[model samples]
Target: MTEIVIETRSGTLAGIGEAGLTRFLGIPYASAARFEAPGPVAAWQGTRAADRFGRQCPQQFGGKVRRDVLESETYGEDCLYLNVFRPEGGSVGPKPVMVWIHGGAFLAGGANAYDASRLAREGDIIVVTINYRIGVLGFVNFADALGLPAIPSNIGLRDQIAALEWVRDTIADFGGDPGKVTICGQSAGSMSVSLLMLSPRARGLFHGAVMQSGAVSLIHDRERSIRDARRYAEALKLDQSRLQRLKTMDIADLMRAQAIVGKQLKNAIPAAPWYDGDVLPASFDEAVATPTAPVPLLAGATRDEVRLFDLMPGDILPTKWDDLKGLLRDQFGPEQTARILATYPRSRKGRIALGSDLTFVMPTRHFAERHARGNPTWFYRFDYAHPLVGAAHGLDLTMFWPFSGLKMALVRGGPDKGRRAELGQRMRSHVAHFVRHGDPGDIWPRYEAESRKVRIYDLADSFAANPEAERYAAWAGRDVEPGRGK
Candidate 1:
């Protein structure tokens, strides 16, 4: 087996690797007990086996996540680890590093789904993916449980910070630059990026950030989060004094509680990462709207983000249009609804566009342009459809990382195989170049107010500075609910 050594705060750890890239997996960054506080990783002697992936945080099973990832064990309250990827042979001085934070709505997800081999090999960028605590163990604040002070809510985010500290200290030995680290994530990972921008604990961990489809609009005030916490405690059937007992409960019980709380909350409020008046201070919207912290940002969204997930049955597409019309009237009232209907019209195209625009693309561009005033911001719209998926959510990641072979299943015996493959090469090139250098190159210009430039990636033709001002303006100040794109 090929092997390499890196010195961590604990000790020197030797990680075995393969021909393509050197990957260090299951490296502990922080240690936390169930319902306890996380501080730092425990010091170890000699070396640890980082050859295998660490445990992923627990979540509800049976979904779109890969089977390889699903087969991984669930480590509740004990899921703080990061994986490092380095090219086979590289100089150590200052290689670009991209630290990835996985997204699962702050409740269910892990980092193992992403394979950084291609990014490390092709992009020549060292990639580190980390796992943080999720659900109640990571969140769900029970006030003064067992005579402790207000429990830290967003322990998951703190895990990310700890992993970055590990990266800062150890990545140099793995042929990565500690100073040139760039943090990039999609969906919940993007939300984490936005929240990290506001967190004092996360400052200086990374220099630049790329937020893809970060819908930070769905957050609650501190009072509201605390209120939700009380309800979660009630569901757990734990008295204020015996809240410590939760730590001793079975891991399955914890998962059940998480699912229950998740279902109950639904769209009421996010159960994790509250505006704790300390960790998060205020909601992300408030932080970005008022020009709080200044950080370089590249944020964007896919064109048909919602069509990928159809909550309703396919048979009801016809009758659903009537309900959509009524929803339009209820949201905007008679006159604006009429105007909206006139503007978008009632059709299959209208329905898909409205959902996709409001749910993802609009919020994405709005967050970018609004923050552009105070920070160096670049925006992109991924109109590049996968022919079948039609530019859906999480599609671009397969092209960027080129792992797990999931996206390959979307295509079959087709004469257009080589053309799609070539276009995918271009996508990887663009993303890798962006991660290595702060710019996405001449094909995608730096977004500025004077010229709301955008890079459109598609199979037919690709170009930069293509603005979606109409979509952006319509959903700019809307309430971020369903059908608000109308």
Candidate 2:
């Protein structure tokens, strides 16, 4: 395990650990950002220590406890890096490669959270997990703010592009076929992949994509994104002249500002991708309708995706009940509100399911349907729930990466272990096959206009066309307004 050395343009680095594979951790892709502007990392002479994880960019604490995770790791302005994993006894010939971008809304998450060893080891492919900017430091827009000459909005995406460039140039030495790369991610990461699908800068960077639980439908416009920035600025009390003072402020201070701004707006400002007329020219539906990228795609969502984040449904039930019919009419209109209530009664589980379908599940299906019209598309619905948790949003990540018995351990106390393993194999196989041959395996036919087939992941695997029709029909056929929070 210790004898393997991977040589890249920057130099050779040693990696440890195994999942029946050779795993390399924390290899630099871009130069350390300084003063917040994107820059190039000058080439080095000696073997750089690409053995450890890079510093994950700064972000606010939402729910997950990651303080200890960050304690021993180094982080700084120069934090652009990625990790690679390959099967130990993998065929000597080139292997397919998959690059992963993580999701924490768009405010936080890192490559370190996921260990690609299991995927690389079992699937016999090259697995790369990448780190990118998050929160105000990464996506906050201030292009016209004269005080900050160093900061740039969307540095996070630029970092992702740089990482792909690194893979194109350096991955072959690590036993990967750069030409067969498949870029995949979930939530904001999926949103990132969607943007890259339309980006001229990202063209030819990868041959395929797999998006889980996110799509192009939710990207904020420039005005919306800038409005978020203004909220952040107001939270920090930074005037135009004092805006540059942000770089020197404590990272924690910025994080607090982010949380404050997020709270002050009552969680309204979603500063994700923007239609900058450059990276993303229009909304995802508009772009796809115009025939955006021809790249083969695999896209889907969990059966109850919103359970992980917005678990409580009674919150909405109470907020609108005072003006129940009017608010219901606001959402579904007077004519259709009654129909919606009839379809999804206010039971303990009904509202939660409705919320999930409205926010993540149905939108994802809509995205696939729109894209399938123009490109080869595959759709899936993950419904295998753990005993305590339903088929939640992040469960697929646990199976695909299968890391330190962490998430799997927490969720495996029931009779679902065998089912989990089966689903893991089937899903991983589809992902690996997609990376290699631009297809998601033989589980189901490619989504077509007439057939509309989708591979469903439950206690057992099955095939159907738009299997969530009941929920989808309730949402689509009826005139429900988009989720206000989304």
lDDT (0 to 1) per candidate: 0.66, 0.70
> What's model 2's TM-score?
0.87
What 10-residue stretch in candidate 1 is worst by lDDT?
311-320
Model 1 agreement with the true structure over 1-486: per-residue lDDT tens digits: 687777766877778778868788888887887655567777898878788888887655322223333234645445677888887765545678889988765666788888888767877788899898766667666653333464566667777777888888878777678888878888778878777777777788788888887656544555555665666666678775665576677666655555555455432322566665566765544555544246677888877666655543222111245554665577657775565555555676777777666556766676677777777777777776756657777776655555444335453112224665565677656556767777666556677777888777666545455354554444444534331111
TM of each candidate vs. truth: 0.85, 0.87
Local accuracy of candidate 2 as per-residue lDDT tens digits, 1-486 = 464666777777777744467767777777754335455566677666556787777665453334433333565555687888778776678998899999987776788888777677667889899988776667776564334544655767878888888889888888788888899999889878877887777888898999998766555666666677777777777877775576677666666776666665532333455666665664433455555467889998887676675543222211222243454577666656665556766764776566566556666777677678878999888877756768877877766656545545685434225776677778888888888788977756998768778888876888887675665665663322222323
- Candidate 1 residue runs with Cα over 4 Å from true position: 61-76, 90-92, 144-148, 265-270, 290-293, 311-342, 386-389, 405-408, 411-417, 464-466, 477-486
Steric collisions counted per model: 0, 1
Candidate with best TM-score:
2
Worst 10 residues of 2 by lDDT: 313-322
